[model samples]
Target: MPVVLSLNIASKTIPVDYTRTGVTGIDKRPVDGPLEVRPPGKKGSSGSGVAGDTIGDLTAHGGDYQAVYGYAREDLDYWQGELGLDLRNGQFGENLTTQGIDHTHARIGEQWRVGTATLEVSAARIPCRTFAEFLGQRGWVKRFTQVARPGAYFRVLEAGRFAPGDEITVLRRPDHDVTVELFFRALTTEAELLPRLLEAGDSVPPQVIELVHKRSVIELDS
Candidate 1:
């Protein structure tokens, strides 16, 4: 059964030895007991989906479409062996470290009822400079993109509390061929796949849909 292996949150942005942007809430820590979860709201500057959590750069971080981030523990375990290190839960800055779910294969707009909250898969985490800095790996962006196991972000539908060990019940999956890994590839290395993103319909973020359409037109013109 799919379940949340760990719940993580950062109360404030903190300084880091690496990265110029100070690394922000990338250093999330696991918490015990139940914690409130909700939409980051319409404001770009909202804290994370978890109550009391904070995001440093609102311009790139918090938003309604990216209210929560989730990564599968199995995927992290694979990276642990590849990196030859013991990676802890929340190390990837995921709000929920899940088990038994395949992040890469997760369907866009898939709904999961966790505890009392309902969340729908919205997008995949895009590797950024800060994320590379957090990992302290050279050519991290390229490497991660090639590996292409970017975790999924979720939009909160029903606000409620959840805890580590809570079961995640799949409520529904949208009738789309777009998976998280596919979406990430389309956004990054594979422009040819951009047209396929349209199959996702409204499940794809509106801004992203617009961008893809623009790219499609440019490709046709070129």
Candidate 2:
């Protein structure tokens, strides 16, 4: 049984570029009270975590497919040793810092009953230049990719509120065998695994599906 160790929300501050040492919403702070979670749209386009969390780049960060970001406390512990920094909750830009959930082992499309809402795993958070700059780590993107512990992003299925200490239970799991790690690898370093993504069916992210189609066409043409 996984539990929400902390819930974080970003302030409504002006967006700043994360790369080149600029500020970004990646710095989320813990919220002590319950916050509404819902699908991304005009009213709540930021996605499912806290009501007014700000994302610097809406184009790549917030949306329906990435409504919620969850990271395991265990993984953070491992990174703390490697980075030698006191990494705290929300430091990874995750809305929920979770415990007892094997994020890497979680399959895409797996549904979890978290707090009063139901969320479905949709995609894995890909590292970017912004993340690297935020952490002030040289080659942070490549280093994080090698670790293959990208946290999970989820879509809000049933809108509700969630707070710290909320229990997360697996409500359902898709039959397909596309685990988060496999999907991340295929998307980042393992093009050879692209074709196998077909097994993920509709649960796979549309962007990845498009990439797979393009790869298949190129392979066929060659």
Candidate 3:
């Protein structure tokens, strides 16, 4: 009934001067560390809570590698087929590759143990234009965000350190079924999805909240 192998992190986005670009970038660094989640108040380059969009999470925030799940070698092929993706590239910046646990299926209020810290799958990653440039597509960024399934946004329940090959055990999953993929769609463009997702703000992280709010306002004014 459960399938989660491990979560890992890295000291930097890449080896000294190692730039991550294209689908092959996932193979650049294969290391993991204790999971860490960022809250609204967490420091950002602007001294405010900044949430990186899905693709940006791996590159924009300048984060090395954070939370990730493990799965079979072919799991990626499965997702590419399931999502109709190219499968040759990865948009998430996580240094840790995934295996069994379906990141797309992760939902709000779900709790899991990552290394020594506990995390709740609260929201989905929101892709930004910066990611489009990284992905080498002019429209891929917006297209990816619309497709959602942008991986899970984990809210850190506790702070700690982790490394590659560390096992992540899911403690419990709340009684919600809406997935991170659906959530991204609803919030970014569903227009009506923001209110419903915000209604459960306690379970949603500020980063996700801010993105939804920003999109709604942008659309409203447009």
Which candidate number maximizes lDDT?
1
Candidate 3's C-alpha runs over 4 A off are 1-28, 32-91, 207-222
What is the lDDT of every predicted structure here?
0.86, 0.84, 0.50
lDDT of 1 by residue, 13-104 (tens): 88875555555888788998599888877645575788877787776787877888999999999999999989999999999999998878
lDDT, candidate 2, 1-222, per-residue tens: 689999987875444565432456787889885888888852224543458787766666777778889999999999999999999998898999999998887998899999899998888889998778777899999999999999998888899989999999999988878888988899899989888877877667677789999988998999
Model 2 — which ten-residue stretch has the worst lDDT?
41-50
lDDT of 2 at 146: 98
- How far residue 188's Cα lies from its native spot in candidate 3, in Å, is 2.0
How many pairs of residues collide in each model? 0, 0, 21
TM-score of 1: 0.93
Measured by TM-score, the strongest candidate is 1
In model 3, the worst 10-residue window by lDDT is: 47-56
Higher-scoring candidate on lDDT, 1 or 3? 1
Query: What TM-score do all the candidates reach, one by one?
Result: 0.93, 0.92, 0.61
lDDT of 2: 0.84
What's the lDDT for residue 222 in model 1? 100
What are the runs in model 2 whose C-alpha is more than 4 Å off?
13-23, 42-49
